[model samples]
Target: MTSKPVIIVTGADLAPEALALLGDYEVAFAGRTPQAADLVALARKHNPVGMIVRYGSVTAEVMDAAPALKVISKHGTGTDTIDKAAAQARGITVTAAAGANAAAVAEHALALMLACAKSVVKLDARMHAGHWDKATHKSLELNGLTVGLIGLGAIGRRFARMCDAIGMRVIGFDPFAADLPDYIEAVPLDKIWEASDVISLQCPLTADNKEMVNAATLARCKPGVILINTARGGLIDEAALFQAVQSGRVAAAGLDSFAREPMSAPHIFQRQPGFVLSPHIGGVTSAAYVNMGVAAATNTVAVLNSVREPAVGQQ
Candidate 1:
């Protein structure tokens, strides 16, 4: 009997379709929300040639444990969780199922923006309590609003299209992007900070850009700016956000991710009326889950078999 090839599943949740894609591979799952040590243990036990990694930190230790590991496939677009330096040093190929979940994340961003503008959450609570809020909670129109994007990558470009369809002017800041699509004006970072009515974060978190939405940056934003973040939680300093929102400098904020996951209790922004929080479901749509899973699995298989992987979107 032929020994099945082994593959390790990291922090990101997997759909059955992904497993089906790897027909003969022996799959070993590192439980959801695994730490670096857990990944190392799993790699040592499985001795995998490839890994379908999600959000866990893939450190040098984890790579050392898997001497045969040839590839690491990211289930989503972001590769921040993986230590690319170590992986590259070990001659391991890293691929991402980029843009596989862009639509779902873009939709979530739009939902948050609209909910904030329409006071949807606030009104829903009042209605459930048998109270009418016709007079106090006024809503804003998005038709003529200008929405700024921090990054014009796959997800940001997708969100820009949605904003255009809704008659909202779109301007964005992305140092690497050139010749943007119609209706999106590429602007400097300072322009976005000063001129935008609403700002959304779609960029990856880097050492240079970490907590870019802190106090100094927030001070430049137009008064009553609405903020939305479907990206990393570390992108925004929650303390600064809490203070800004509390002071009404930022009228509302929609956050899908936070600095810490499975968020702690009694967070300052927990009960704030102007903030809408989601448990990082930006890319978890039913359709996206399958797409990302299959893509990641395929990428893993391709690299292991020395086949060229399909063209992936922005990562």
Candidate 2:
């Protein structure tokens, strides 16, 4: 029997090719919805050298249970669910599949932008309900509109390019980017809110950015502005957004992610007009899934073999 280092994969749906690439390691499959306690127990039994976690939080207790764990690889870009400080304290290296799902997320954001501008959701609902009300004539063309993208990271840059290609003027706000693309006019964050006809958020949610798009910011925007968020949910204040839509300050909003996941059927947005919600499927495309899964698996193997260093930043 080959005595390769054991690896535990939680909620991973890796392709055969990707799995074959990790032939030197012995992998154990853990179901997608494994309980935290069950994961801890599995970690104890497997004594895994590496772990790949998908959705659930990898708590300190779970980390403590795995005495042999050397690395924790996140299947996606977000690391907010993991206890990073605790993992660092134990000297366990953490990495994520950042930029792997950028294309899919960018595409989704653009789709949302188009849907909001065209009033697609509202029109469809009205038609399905047997209402011939032609009062939904406020649909605007996106070509000449100003698009403000918050954060010019991989996803943000891609979204900006797409917007520019469609004839929209693209403006960006990314304090970290020393130089932006020629097509994107770098502007102040507040200026983005003031001048943009459509504002799409692509920035990560941080302590400094929680509820960044609150009532105060919404009040500063142009009247009937459209908002789209494909990034973290904490960036916008939900209650404030609800009020903004109710007051007609925000013409429409397309949200793929929310403060809470698997949203309740009777959420406020369902009753609110001009609101389109998705079940966090921005990066759920087949290509994106494969890209992220392979990147995560490769990173996990690299960490175990000491071929590469852990990626910096929390996400």
Candidate 3:
């Protein structure tokens, strides 16, 4: 019998269609939230050539256990959970399914903005209570408002176009992009906070960028500004954000990612008013799942076959 190159999938099961695309590869499944010890054991035992990780940290210790592992394919866009420097030093290729969920994330951010602006949650609660409170007039109109986007990458650019189509004045901040759409004025990061009625975070979280949007940055934003973050949770300090919302400095916040997962008991943001929370489902839509899964699988196969360089990281 021919021994197929082994691949381990960490996290939930891949969609049936995504699995079907893998053809005859020998694939193993692991829990979505596997412990470090479990990961180390699995890697040592399976010695898979590739791994598709979602939401689990691929630490150096885990990597060390997997001597035969050649590639790490992140099931989603963010690679913050993985130890990139370690992987690079070991000459193991690391790739993420970047741009695969751009549209889904952009749509989620837009939905958050609308929900916050109109107080959708609160209004729904009031209606359910049988209170005739039609006199409440705390909603803000999104039309003609200034929407500031941080990091004009694939997701950011898509959001900018969507906001522009909705009659919003779109302004962007991306240090790397040389040019932007005519409708999106390329502004300094500070100016984006100052002029924006709504600020949507689309940047990746890195060591230098953790807690990038803290109390100091939040202080620069326009009063009553709406905040939407479908990106990494560590990008904003949850404590500082809670204080800002409590003090009325921030009107509302929509969060798809948080500092912790499952958001079980004792989650900080659960009790906050004017807050909309999603279970990190910004990029988990049906379409997004298929796109990202296919991308990761195809990328994994390519790396295994030595067909091309991995599509993520600097060499």
Candidate 4:
């Protein structure tokens, strides 16, 4: 049989076990941050029957070039990068490895909460610069604080249980989640804005809710509330967040993702007090990386082999 071709359209390569599952196929990787034109070139050259996406946008132009492309598998949960309507128009099956990385992401969310409260990054930098500065970046204890989660999906639920175990009250506004446990009491959006000492966003980025954390919402929040975002970057308005953080209205923020990838220098967040940032690695762990890779690879293979996939609540 002729070798089947598949392109990994981002920086990550599938784990060895995932690659082993595709022994019958040929694989190709596009180096990190490839231009759209370069990605289109790869599609033209490979004529791949399937594509595994991780980072960067997969536009309609790239899809149009691959005449044989039948499947597009997302390396992680977010499908916002891929042009789904365009793929569907071409009769391509789009799949994502959802919930496989929930544990890792939830752990990162907790890490951000601790980091924001304790000034982990800033203090480490202070020590590096030969200044103790312990008096300035005072730590906040979490034992009695209320944590408001924006969404109660896989990551949100895991984080909630962790907070509950630590003796913190857990509440949130998840309209989609029905029959939540006693630990997580669902509330209205207005209540989350007013009551939470720490607000962690876990909602998917919807067109209706983009930049939901804007000036209007921030004005209503309790002063000095810590903000944590391990979900989509587009969820928060960067300009409003900067002003809030600078003015001490929002005490601190821990962000694992940003509105712009490779956040530019002199951006509003630079040299700001009580804010920590990570480069979108919330779901990246030794185990989750491999699990996600395998899950996405299998999803693509299943569609190609006419094998039915288990129903997953994925976008």
Overall lDDT per candidate, in order of appearance: 0.90, 0.86, 0.87, 0.87
Give the distance in Å from residue 17's predicted Cα in candidate 4 to where it truly belongs. 1.4
Clashes of 2: 0
Residue pairs in collision within model 2: none
Local lDDT at 313 for model 3:
86
Cα displacement (angstroms), candidate 4, residue 303, comes to: 1.1
Give per-model TM-scores. 0.93, 0.90, 0.94, 0.92
For 1-315, candidate 1 gives per-residue lDDT tens digits of 128868888854589998898986888788888888888888888788898887677888999999988999989988878889899999999999989999999999999999999989988998999999787767999998899999998899999999999999999999998878989999999999899999999998888898999999999999999999999998999999999998899999999999887788878889878999999999999999999999999999878776435446822
Give the winner by TM-score: 1 or 4: 1
RMSD in Å for candidate 1, one decimal?
4.4
lDDT of 3 by residue, 185-278 (tens): 9999889879999999999988887998899999998989999999998888999999889888899999998876666677768877968999
Candidate 4, residues 204-228, lDDT tens digits: the string is 8878889999999999999999999
Model 2, residue 169: distance off in Å is 1.3
- For candidate 2, the lDDT comes to 0.86
Candidate 2 lDDT score at position 167? 98
In model 4, the worst 10-residue window by lDDT is 306-315
In candidate 2, position 184 carries an lDDT of 97
Judging by lDDT against the true structure, name the best candidate.
1
Question: Least accurate stretch of 10 residues (summed lDDT) in model 1?
Answer: 306-315
Q: Which rank order by TM-score, best down to worst? A: 3, 1, 4, 2
Clashes of 3: 1
